[model samples]
Target: MGQIIIFLVLLGLGYFFGRMAESRHYKRIHQREQAYRKLLVMPEKIPPLEFSQHESTLVSGNVVISVDYFKTVAAGLRSIFGGRVAAYESLLDRARREAILRMQEEAKAKGADAIYNLKFETARIGQNAGQSLGSVEVLAYGTALIPTPDMRAERIARNNLVQGK
Candidate 1:
Protein backbone atom coordinates (compact mmCIF):
# COMPACT_ATOMS: atom_id res chain seq x y z
CA MET A 1 0.00 0.00 0.00
CA GLY A 2 2.82 2.41 0.82
CA GLN A 3 4.52 1.76 -2.53
CA ILE A 4 1.30 2.34 -4.44
CA ILE A 5 0.75 5.62 -2.60
CA ILE A 6 4.25 6.80 -3.46
CA PHE A 7 3.77 5.90 -7.10
CA LEU A 8 0.53 7.82 -7.33
CA VAL A 9 2.11 10.86 -5.66
CA LEU A 10 4.94 10.85 -8.16
CA LEU A 11 2.57 10.51 -11.07
CA GLY A 12 0.51 13.41 -9.78
CA LEU A 13 3.57 15.61 -9.44
CA GLY A 14 4.73 14.71 -12.93
CA TYR A 15 1.37 15.51 -14.44
CA PHE A 16 1.10 18.84 -12.68
CA PHE A 17 4.55 20.10 -13.62
CA GLY A 18 4.42 18.75 -17.12
CA ARG A 19 1.09 20.40 -17.82
CA MET A 20 2.32 23.74 -16.47
CA ALA A 21 5.39 23.70 -18.65
CA GLU A 22 3.46 22.73 -21.74
CA SER A 23 0.94 25.48 -21.15
CA ARG A 24 3.69 28.08 -20.82
CA HIS A 25 5.34 26.91 -24.00
CA TYR A 26 2.12 27.02 -25.93
CA LYS A 27 1.39 30.53 -24.71
CA ARG A 28 4.79 31.70 -25.81
CA ILE A 29 4.37 30.08 -29.19
CA HIS A 30 1.02 31.75 -29.79
CA GLN A 31 2.41 35.14 -28.85
CA ARG A 32 5.30 34.80 -31.24
CA GLU A 33 3.01 33.51 -33.98
CA GLN A 34 0.90 36.62 -33.70
CA ALA A 35 3.95 38.82 -33.67
CA TYR A 36 5.35 37.28 -36.84
CA ARG A 37 2.12 36.89 -38.78
CA LYS A 38 3.17 39.45 -41.36
CA LEU A 39 6.09 37.33 -42.55
CA LEU A 40 5.17 35.54 -45.76
CA VAL A 41 6.21 31.88 -45.76
CA MET A 42 5.48 29.60 -48.69
CA PRO A 43 6.64 26.37 -50.40
CA GLU A 44 6.87 27.58 -53.98
CA LYS A 45 10.06 26.74 -55.80
CA ILE A 46 10.38 30.26 -57.12
CA PRO A 47 8.99 33.58 -56.05
CA PRO A 48 6.81 35.48 -58.49
CA LEU A 49 8.78 37.15 -61.28
CA GLU A 50 6.98 40.44 -60.66
CA PHE A 51 9.39 41.07 -57.77
CA SER A 52 12.46 40.51 -59.88
CA GLN A 53 14.30 43.41 -58.33
CA HIS A 54 14.50 41.63 -54.95
CA GLU A 55 17.40 39.42 -53.91
CA SER A 56 16.96 35.97 -52.44
CA THR A 57 19.08 34.23 -49.83
CA LEU A 58 18.79 31.12 -47.71
CA VAL A 59 17.58 31.19 -44.10
CA SER A 60 17.17 28.36 -41.62
CA GLY A 61 16.04 27.62 -38.08
CA ASN A 62 16.44 24.53 -35.92
CA VAL A 63 14.96 23.49 -32.60
CA VAL A 64 15.11 20.41 -30.34
CA ILE A 65 12.40 19.51 -27.83
CA SER A 66 12.15 16.64 -25.35
CA VAL A 67 9.13 14.92 -23.87
CA ASP A 68 8.47 15.32 -20.20
CA TYR A 69 8.48 12.35 -17.82
CA PHE A 70 4.69 12.35 -17.63
CA LYS A 71 4.45 12.32 -21.40
CA THR A 72 6.92 9.44 -21.70
CA VAL A 73 4.90 7.36 -19.25
CA ALA A 74 1.67 8.21 -21.03
CA ALA A 75 3.17 7.27 -24.38
CA GLY A 76 4.25 3.90 -23.00
CA LEU A 77 0.73 3.15 -21.90
CA ARG A 78 -0.65 4.39 -25.22
CA SER A 79 1.57 1.94 -27.09
CA ILE A 80 -0.07 -0.92 -25.29
CA PHE A 81 -3.49 0.41 -26.24
CA GLY A 82 -2.32 0.94 -29.84
CA GLY A 83 -3.80 4.33 -30.42
CA ARG A 84 -2.66 7.90 -31.02
CA VAL A 85 -0.14 9.47 -28.68
CA ALA A 86 -1.46 13.01 -28.20
CA ALA A 87 1.41 13.99 -25.92
CA TYR A 88 4.05 13.33 -28.52
CA GLU A 89 1.90 14.92 -31.19
CA SER A 90 1.71 18.18 -29.27
CA LEU A 91 5.43 18.07 -28.60
CA LEU A 92 6.17 17.80 -32.31
CA ASP A 93 3.70 20.52 -33.15
CA ARG A 94 5.34 22.92 -30.74
CA ALA A 95 8.78 22.12 -32.02
CA ARG A 96 7.76 22.60 -35.63
CA ARG A 97 6.06 25.93 -34.94
CA GLU A 98 9.06 27.16 -32.95
CA ALA A 99 11.42 26.20 -35.72
CA ILE A 100 9.36 28.13 -38.27
CA LEU A 101 9.22 31.16 -35.98
CA ARG A 102 12.97 31.16 -35.61
CA MET A 103 13.39 30.97 -39.35
CA GLN A 104 11.04 33.88 -39.83
CA GLU A 105 12.99 35.85 -37.25
CA GLU A 106 16.20 35.29 -39.17
CA ALA A 107 14.58 36.46 -42.37
CA LYS A 108 13.17 39.51 -40.64
CA ALA A 109 16.63 40.39 -39.30
CA LYS A 110 17.86 40.44 -42.90
CA GLY A 111 14.94 42.70 -43.94
CA ALA A 112 13.31 40.00 -46.01
CA ASP A 113 9.88 40.69 -47.48
CA ALA A 114 8.95 37.04 -47.94
CA ILE A 115 10.18 33.46 -47.72
CA TYR A 116 9.85 30.96 -50.52
CA ASN A 117 10.78 27.34 -51.23
CA LEU A 118 10.19 26.44 -47.60
CA LYS A 119 11.22 22.97 -46.45
CA PHE A 120 11.44 21.02 -43.24
CA GLU A 121 13.78 18.31 -41.95
CA THR A 122 13.18 16.38 -38.76
CA ALA A 123 15.37 13.99 -36.73
CA ARG A 124 15.41 12.14 -33.41
CA ILE A 125 18.27 12.89 -31.06
CA GLY A 126 19.89 11.97 -27.72
CA GLN A 127 18.62 8.40 -27.48
CA ASN A 128 20.82 5.77 -25.80
CA ALA A 129 20.64 2.05 -26.57
CA GLY A 130 17.80 1.36 -24.15
CA GLN A 131 16.22 4.74 -23.93
CA SER A 132 12.85 5.69 -25.40
CA LEU A 133 12.53 8.79 -27.56
CA GLY A 134 14.96 11.25 -26.07
CA SER A 135 14.10 14.29 -28.14
CA VAL A 136 12.95 15.57 -31.54
CA GLU A 137 14.81 18.09 -33.72
CA VAL A 138 13.06 20.15 -36.34
CA LEU A 139 14.79 22.22 -39.01
CA ALA A 140 13.00 24.76 -41.18
CA TYR A 141 14.65 26.39 -44.16
CA GLY A 142 13.62 28.78 -46.90
CA THR A 143 14.72 31.42 -49.34
CA ALA A 144 14.27 34.97 -48.13
CA LEU A 145 13.60 37.74 -50.65
CA ILE A 146 14.88 41.16 -49.72
CA PRO A 147 14.03 44.36 -51.49
CA THR A 148 16.72 46.26 -53.42
CA PRO A 149 18.51 49.24 -51.94
CA ASP A 150 16.41 51.75 -53.85
CA MET A 151 13.17 50.07 -52.82
CA ARG A 152 14.27 49.99 -49.21
CA ALA A 153 15.04 53.69 -49.23
CA GLU A 154 11.65 54.44 -50.78
CA ARG A 155 9.88 52.36 -48.16
CA ILE A 156 11.77 54.09 -45.37
CA ALA A 157 10.88 57.51 -46.74
CA ARG A 158 7.22 56.55 -47.15
CA ASN A 159 7.05 55.23 -43.60
CA ASN A 160 8.72 58.35 -42.24
CA LEU A 161 6.12 60.59 -43.89
CA VAL A 162 3.26 58.37 -42.75
CA GLN A 163 4.47 58.58 -39.15
CA GLY A 164 5.16 62.33 -39.41
CA LYS A 165 8.89 61.70 -39.02
Candidate 2:
Protein backbone atom coordinates (compact mmCIF):
# COMPACT_ATOMS: atom_id res chain seq x y z
CA MET A 1 0.00 0.00 0.00
CA GLY A 2 2.77 2.42 0.90
CA GLN A 3 4.57 1.72 -2.37
CA ILE A 4 1.44 2.35 -4.34
CA ILE A 5 0.86 5.62 -2.52
CA ILE A 6 4.39 6.78 -3.31
CA PHE A 7 3.99 5.85 -6.93
CA LEU A 8 0.76 7.78 -7.14
CA VAL A 9 2.36 10.84 -5.61
CA LEU A 10 5.27 10.65 -8.04
CA LEU A 11 2.88 10.28 -10.94
CA GLY A 12 0.94 13.36 -9.86
CA LEU A 13 4.11 15.37 -9.56
CA GLY A 14 5.29 14.23 -12.94
CA TYR A 15 2.01 15.17 -14.56
CA PHE A 16 2.03 18.65 -13.08
CA PHE A 17 5.65 19.42 -13.99
CA GLY A 18 5.46 17.84 -17.38
CA ARG A 19 2.49 19.95 -18.35
CA MET A 20 4.20 23.13 -17.24
CA ALA A 21 7.36 22.38 -19.15
CA GLU A 22 5.51 21.40 -22.27
CA SER A 23 3.45 24.56 -22.19
CA ARG A 24 6.51 26.74 -21.94
CA HIS A 25 8.20 24.87 -24.73
CA TYR A 26 5.14 25.26 -26.95
CA LYS A 27 5.06 28.99 -26.38
CA ARG A 28 8.68 29.31 -27.37
CA ILE A 29 8.16 27.22 -30.43
CA HIS A 30 5.26 29.36 -31.56
CA GLN A 31 7.29 32.54 -31.24
CA ARG A 32 10.18 31.11 -33.17
CA GLU A 33 7.86 29.75 -35.83
CA GLN A 34 6.32 33.17 -36.39
CA ALA A 35 9.73 34.79 -36.60
CA TYR A 36 10.91 32.32 -39.22
CA ARG A 37 7.73 32.22 -41.26
CA LYS A 38 9.29 34.06 -44.15
CA LEU A 39 11.87 31.37 -44.71
CA LEU A 40 10.18 29.19 -47.31
CA VAL A 41 10.28 25.45 -46.65
CA MET A 42 8.92 22.95 -49.13
CA PRO A 43 8.86 19.19 -49.65
CA GLU A 44 8.72 19.19 -53.44
CA LYS A 45 11.69 17.54 -55.12
CA ILE A 46 11.92 20.27 -57.70
CA PRO A 47 12.23 23.90 -56.80
CA PRO A 48 10.05 26.54 -58.43
CA LEU A 49 11.16 28.02 -61.74
CA GLU A 50 12.42 31.17 -60.04
CA PHE A 51 14.86 29.13 -57.98
CA SER A 52 16.06 26.98 -60.86
CA GLN A 53 19.36 28.82 -61.09
CA HIS A 54 19.94 29.12 -57.34
CA GLU A 55 22.83 27.45 -55.53
CA SER A 56 21.97 24.36 -53.48
CA THR A 57 23.33 23.20 -50.15
CA LEU A 58 22.29 20.58 -47.65
CA VAL A 59 20.88 21.75 -44.31
CA SER A 60 19.65 19.62 -41.46
CA GLY A 61 18.56 19.76 -37.85
CA ASN A 62 17.98 17.07 -35.27
CA VAL A 63 16.45 16.99 -31.80
CA VAL A 64 16.14 14.27 -29.18
CA ILE A 65 13.15 14.56 -26.84
CA SER A 66 12.75 12.45 -23.74
CA VAL A 67 9.40 11.27 -22.47
CA ASP A 68 8.46 12.48 -19.03
CA TYR A 69 7.69 10.08 -16.23
CA PHE A 70 3.96 10.76 -16.38
CA LYS A 71 3.91 10.20 -20.14
CA THR A 72 5.75 6.93 -19.78
CA VAL A 73 3.33 5.70 -17.15
CA ALA A 74 0.30 6.82 -19.12
CA ALA A 75 1.61 5.24 -22.29
CA GLY A 76 2.22 1.95 -20.52
CA LEU A 77 -1.34 1.93 -19.26
CA ARG A 78 -2.67 2.83 -22.69
CA SER A 79 -0.66 0.07 -24.37
CA ILE A 80 -2.31 -2.57 -22.22
CA PHE A 81 -5.73 -1.50 -23.49
CA GLY A 82 -4.56 -1.43 -27.13
CA GLY A 83 -5.36 1.99 -28.52
CA ARG A 84 -3.66 5.19 -29.54
CA VAL A 85 -1.21 6.44 -26.93
CA ALA A 86 -2.27 10.10 -26.93
CA ALA A 87 0.17 10.84 -24.14
CA TYR A 88 3.15 10.77 -26.51
CA GLU A 89 1.53 12.73 -29.30
CA SER A 90 2.53 16.09 -27.97
CA LEU A 91 6.06 14.85 -27.38
CA LEU A 92 6.50 13.88 -31.00
CA ASP A 93 4.88 17.06 -32.27
CA ARG A 94 7.24 19.18 -30.24
CA ALA A 95 10.29 17.26 -31.40
CA ARG A 96 9.33 17.46 -35.06
CA ARG A 97 8.52 21.17 -34.97
CA GLU A 98 11.75 21.94 -33.13
CA ALA A 99 13.78 20.05 -35.68
CA ILE A 100 12.16 21.94 -38.53
CA LEU A 101 12.68 25.27 -36.81
CA ARG A 102 16.33 24.49 -36.33
CA MET A 103 16.67 23.52 -39.96
CA GLN A 104 15.01 26.74 -41.04
CA GLU A 105 17.40 28.74 -38.90
CA GLU A 106 20.34 27.10 -40.58
CA ALA A 107 18.97 27.86 -44.01
CA LYS A 108 18.27 31.47 -43.10
CA ALA A 109 21.77 31.89 -41.77
CA LYS A 110 23.18 30.63 -45.05
CA GLY A 111 21.20 33.30 -46.97
CA ALA A 112 18.94 30.75 -48.54
CA ASP A 113 15.85 31.89 -50.46
CA ALA A 114 14.07 28.64 -49.75
CA ILE A 115 14.46 25.04 -48.70
CA TYR A 116 13.41 22.25 -51.04
CA ASN A 117 12.94 18.50 -50.72
CA LEU A 118 12.22 18.68 -47.02
CA LYS A 119 12.46 15.29 -45.32
CA PHE A 120 12.12 13.84 -41.87
CA GLU A 121 13.74 10.86 -40.16
CA THR A 122 12.71 9.69 -36.74
CA ALA A 123 14.22 7.04 -34.47
CA ARG A 124 13.84 5.85 -30.92
CA ILE A 125 16.85 6.63 -28.78
CA GLY A 126 18.23 5.79 -25.33
CA GLN A 127 18.81 2.50 -23.53
CA ASN A 128 16.19 -0.22 -23.71
CA ALA A 129 14.33 1.67 -26.39
CA GLY A 130 12.44 -1.38 -27.57
CA GLN A 131 11.58 -2.61 -24.09
CA SER A 132 10.66 0.68 -22.45
CA LEU A 133 10.06 4.36 -22.98
CA GLY A 134 13.03 6.27 -24.32
CA SER A 135 14.01 9.50 -26.03
CA VAL A 136 12.99 10.07 -29.64
CA GLU A 137 15.28 11.67 -32.16
CA VAL A 138 13.74 13.66 -34.97
CA LEU A 139 15.82 14.81 -37.89
CA ALA A 140 14.74 17.38 -40.50
CA TYR A 141 16.72 17.84 -43.64
CA GLY A 142 16.41 19.80 -46.91
CA THR A 143 18.27 21.43 -49.71
CA ALA A 144 18.64 25.18 -49.32
CA LEU A 145 18.39 27.32 -52.43
CA ILE A 146 20.60 30.37 -52.31
CA PRO A 147 19.74 32.91 -54.93
CA THR A 148 22.19 34.27 -57.45
CA PRO A 149 21.60 37.15 -59.84
CA ASP A 150 19.22 36.01 -62.57
CA MET A 151 21.18 35.20 -65.68
CA ARG A 152 18.31 36.17 -67.94
CA ALA A 153 17.93 39.56 -66.32
CA GLU A 154 21.67 40.16 -66.51
CA ARG A 155 21.70 39.30 -70.19
CA ILE A 156 18.80 41.65 -70.89
CA ALA A 157 20.56 44.48 -69.08
CA ARG A 158 23.81 43.82 -70.98
CA ASN A 159 21.95 43.93 -74.30
CA ASN A 160 20.17 47.15 -73.34
CA LEU A 161 23.50 48.77 -72.46
CA VAL A 162 25.14 47.57 -75.68
CA GLN A 163 22.26 49.00 -77.74
CA GLY A 164 22.24 52.24 -75.68
CA LYS A 165 18.49 51.74 -75.20
Candidate 3:
Protein backbone atom coordinates (compact mmCIF):
# COMPACT_ATOMS: atom_id res chain seq x y z
CA MET A 1 0.00 0.00 0.00
CA GLY A 2 2.84 2.35 0.78
CA GLN A 3 4.47 1.62 -2.59
CA ILE A 4 1.24 2.25 -4.43
CA ILE A 5 0.79 5.54 -2.61
CA ILE A 6 4.29 6.63 -3.49
CA PHE A 7 3.78 5.68 -7.15
CA LEU A 8 0.57 7.66 -7.34
CA VAL A 9 2.21 10.69 -5.78
CA LEU A 10 5.05 10.56 -8.28
CA LEU A 11 2.64 10.15 -11.16
CA GLY A 12 0.67 13.16 -10.01
CA LEU A 13 3.75 15.25 -9.72
CA GLY A 14 4.91 14.21 -13.18
CA TYR A 15 1.55 15.11 -14.67
CA PHE A 16 1.49 18.51 -13.02
CA PHE A 17 5.02 19.49 -13.99
CA GLY A 18 4.67 18.10 -17.50
CA ARG A 19 1.53 20.13 -18.11
CA MET A 20 3.17 23.31 -16.86
CA ALA A 21 6.23 22.87 -19.02
CA GLU A 22 4.23 22.03 -22.13
CA SER A 23 2.03 25.07 -21.61
CA ARG A 24 5.02 27.35 -21.25
CA HIS A 25 6.66 25.92 -24.38
CA TYR A 26 3.49 26.37 -26.39
CA LYS A 27 3.19 29.99 -25.29
CA ARG A 28 6.77 30.66 -26.33
CA ILE A 29 6.24 28.99 -29.71
CA HIS A 30 3.13 31.06 -30.41
CA GLN A 31 4.93 34.29 -29.62
CA ARG A 32 7.87 33.38 -31.84
CA GLU A 33 5.57 32.35 -34.66
CA GLN A 34 3.87 35.71 -34.58
CA ALA A 35 7.20 37.49 -34.52
CA TYR A 36 8.43 35.59 -37.60
CA ARG A 37 5.19 35.81 -39.54
CA LYS A 38 6.69 38.25 -42.01
CA LEU A 39 9.27 35.73 -43.11
CA LEU A 40 8.31 33.88 -46.32
CA VAL A 41 8.64 30.14 -46.04
CA MET A 42 7.28 27.94 -48.81
CA PRO A 43 7.38 24.33 -49.99
CA GLU A 44 7.53 25.03 -53.67
CA LYS A 45 10.21 22.96 -55.39
CA ILE A 46 11.20 25.78 -57.70
CA PRO A 47 11.59 29.36 -56.74
CA PRO A 48 9.77 31.96 -58.79
CA LEU A 49 11.74 33.25 -61.75
CA GLU A 50 11.29 36.89 -60.83
CA PHE A 51 13.07 36.32 -57.51
CA SER A 52 15.95 34.48 -59.22
CA GLN A 53 17.91 37.69 -59.36
CA HIS A 54 19.08 36.86 -55.85
CA GLU A 55 21.49 34.12 -54.79
CA SER A 56 20.04 31.01 -53.20
CA THR A 57 21.66 29.13 -50.34
CA LEU A 58 20.70 26.27 -48.12
CA VAL A 59 19.51 26.63 -44.53
CA SER A 60 18.50 23.95 -42.07
CA GLY A 61 17.42 23.49 -38.46
CA ASN A 62 17.11 20.44 -36.29
CA VAL A 63 15.54 19.92 -32.87
CA VAL A 64 15.27 16.96 -30.53
CA ILE A 65 12.53 16.82 -27.90
CA SER A 66 12.18 14.29 -25.10
CA VAL A 67 8.90 12.97 -23.79
CA ASP A 68 8.04 13.76 -20.21
CA TYR A 69 7.51 10.89 -17.81
CA PHE A 70 3.80 11.57 -17.76
CA LYS A 71 3.61 11.57 -21.52
CA THR A 72 5.53 8.31 -21.72
CA VAL A 73 3.10 6.67 -19.32
CA ALA A 74 0.15 8.05 -21.24
CA ALA A 75 1.61 6.73 -24.47
CA GLY A 76 2.03 3.28 -22.97
CA LEU A 77 -1.59 3.26 -21.90
CA ARG A 78 -2.64 4.46 -25.34
CA SER A 79 -0.65 1.68 -26.97
CA ILE A 80 -2.34 -0.91 -24.81
CA PHE A 81 -5.70 0.48 -25.90
CA GLY A 82 -4.62 0.34 -29.58
CA GLY A 83 -5.57 3.91 -30.36
CA ARG A 84 -4.07 7.26 -31.26
CA VAL A 85 -1.35 8.52 -28.95
CA ALA A 86 -2.28 12.15 -28.47
CA ALA A 87 0.66 12.77 -26.17
CA TYR A 88 3.19 11.76 -28.77
CA GLU A 89 1.32 13.69 -31.41
CA SER A 90 1.64 16.91 -29.45
CA LEU A 91 5.29 16.20 -28.83
CA LEU A 92 6.00 15.76 -32.52
CA ASP A 93 4.00 18.89 -33.34
CA ARG A 94 6.05 20.94 -30.93
CA ALA A 95 9.29 19.55 -32.27
CA ARG A 96 8.34 20.27 -35.86
CA ARG A 97 7.35 23.85 -35.07
CA GLU A 98 10.56 24.45 -33.18
CA ALA A 99 12.65 23.07 -36.02
CA ILE A 100 10.89 25.33 -38.51
CA LEU A 101 11.40 28.34 -36.29
CA ARG A 102 15.07 27.63 -35.99
CA MET A 103 15.41 27.24 -39.75
CA GLN A 104 13.67 30.57 -40.26
CA GLU A 105 16.02 32.19 -37.78
CA GLU A 106 19.02 30.88 -39.69
CA ALA A 107 17.66 32.20 -42.96
CA LYS A 108 16.97 35.57 -41.41
CA ALA A 109 20.49 35.70 -40.08
CA LYS A 110 21.79 35.09 -43.60
CA GLY A 111 19.77 38.10 -44.79
CA ALA A 112 17.39 35.98 -46.79
CA ASP A 113 14.22 37.59 -48.07
CA ALA A 114 12.47 34.24 -48.48
CA ILE A 115 12.95 30.53 -48.05
CA TYR A 116 11.78 28.07 -50.68
CA ASN A 117 11.83 24.35 -51.34
CA LEU A 118 11.18 23.66 -47.73
CA LYS A 119 11.42 20.08 -46.54
CA PHE A 120 11.00 18.24 -43.28
CA GLU A 121 12.40 14.99 -41.93
CA THR A 122 11.36 13.34 -38.70
CA ALA A 123 12.78 10.44 -36.75
CA ARG A 124 12.42 8.75 -33.40
CA ILE A 125 15.58 8.88 -31.36
CA GLY A 126 16.85 7.20 -28.17
CA GLN A 127 14.64 4.13 -27.88
CA ASN A 128 14.75 2.33 -24.59
CA ALA A 129 15.11 -1.43 -24.07
CA GLY A 130 11.32 -1.63 -23.85
CA GLN A 131 11.12 -0.20 -27.38
CA SER A 132 9.45 2.95 -26.13
CA LEU A 133 10.28 6.17 -27.92
CA GLY A 134 12.57 8.23 -25.72
CA SER A 135 12.77 11.31 -27.88
CA VAL A 136 11.84 12.68 -31.28
CA GLU A 137 14.01 14.63 -33.72
CA VAL A 138 12.76 16.94 -36.44
CA LEU A 139 14.76 18.52 -39.23
CA ALA A 140 13.56 21.46 -41.27
CA TYR A 141 15.53 22.65 -44.29
CA GLY A 142 15.11 25.07 -47.17
CA THR A 143 16.81 27.23 -49.71
CA ALA A 144 17.09 30.87 -48.81
CA LEU A 145 17.25 33.67 -51.35
CA ILE A 146 19.64 36.49 -50.53
CA PRO A 147 19.32 39.65 -52.53
CA THR A 148 22.49 41.15 -53.99
CA PRO A 149 23.55 44.23 -52.09
CA ASP A 150 24.78 45.98 -55.20
CA MET A 151 21.46 45.48 -56.98
CA ARG A 152 19.54 46.74 -53.98
CA ALA A 153 21.79 49.77 -53.67
CA GLU A 154 21.37 50.55 -57.34
CA ARG A 155 17.62 50.29 -57.10
CA ILE A 156 17.55 52.61 -54.08
CA ALA A 157 19.75 55.09 -55.86
CA ARG A 158 17.55 55.04 -58.93
CA ASN A 159 14.48 55.62 -56.77
CA ASN A 160 16.11 58.53 -54.95
CA LEU A 161 17.26 60.09 -58.23
CA VAL A 162 13.77 59.83 -59.74
CA GLN A 163 12.33 61.44 -56.62
CA GLY A 164 14.72 64.40 -57.14
CA LYS A 165 16.40 63.77 -53.78
RMSD of 3: 2.3
Q: For candidate 2, list the clashing residue pairs, or say none.
A: none
**lDDT tens string, model 2, 1-165?**
999999999999999999999999999999999999989999999999988888999999999999888999999899899899888899999999999999999999888879999999999888465755688999999999986657547767999999999
- Model 1, 1-165: lDDT tens digits are 999999788888888998999899999999999998998999999798866789989999999998777787788898889999997999899999999999999999999999999999999987746556779999999999999899999999999999999
Per-candidate clash tally:
0, 0, 0
In model 3, how large is the Cα lDDT of residue 144? 94
Where model 1 places Cα greater than 4 Å from the true spot, the runs are: 1-3, 128-131, 160-165
Q: lDDT by residue for model 3 over 1-165, one digit each (tens)? A: 999999888888989998898899999999999988988999999998877899989999999998888888888888889989998989989999999999999999998888999999999888888568999999999999988998779889999999999
* lDDT against the true structure, each candidate: 0.90, 0.92, 0.91
Please name the candidate that would achieve the greatest lDDT relative to the true structure: 2
User: After aligning candidate 3 to the native by TM-score, how far in Å is the CA of 126 from where it should be?
Assistant: 1.9
Error of 1 at 22 (Å): 0.9
TM-score attained by model 1: 0.90
Task: Quote each prediction's TM-score.
Answer: 0.90, 0.88, 0.90
Query: Could you report the Cα RMSD, in angstroms, for every candidate shown?
Result: 1.9, 5.3, 2.3
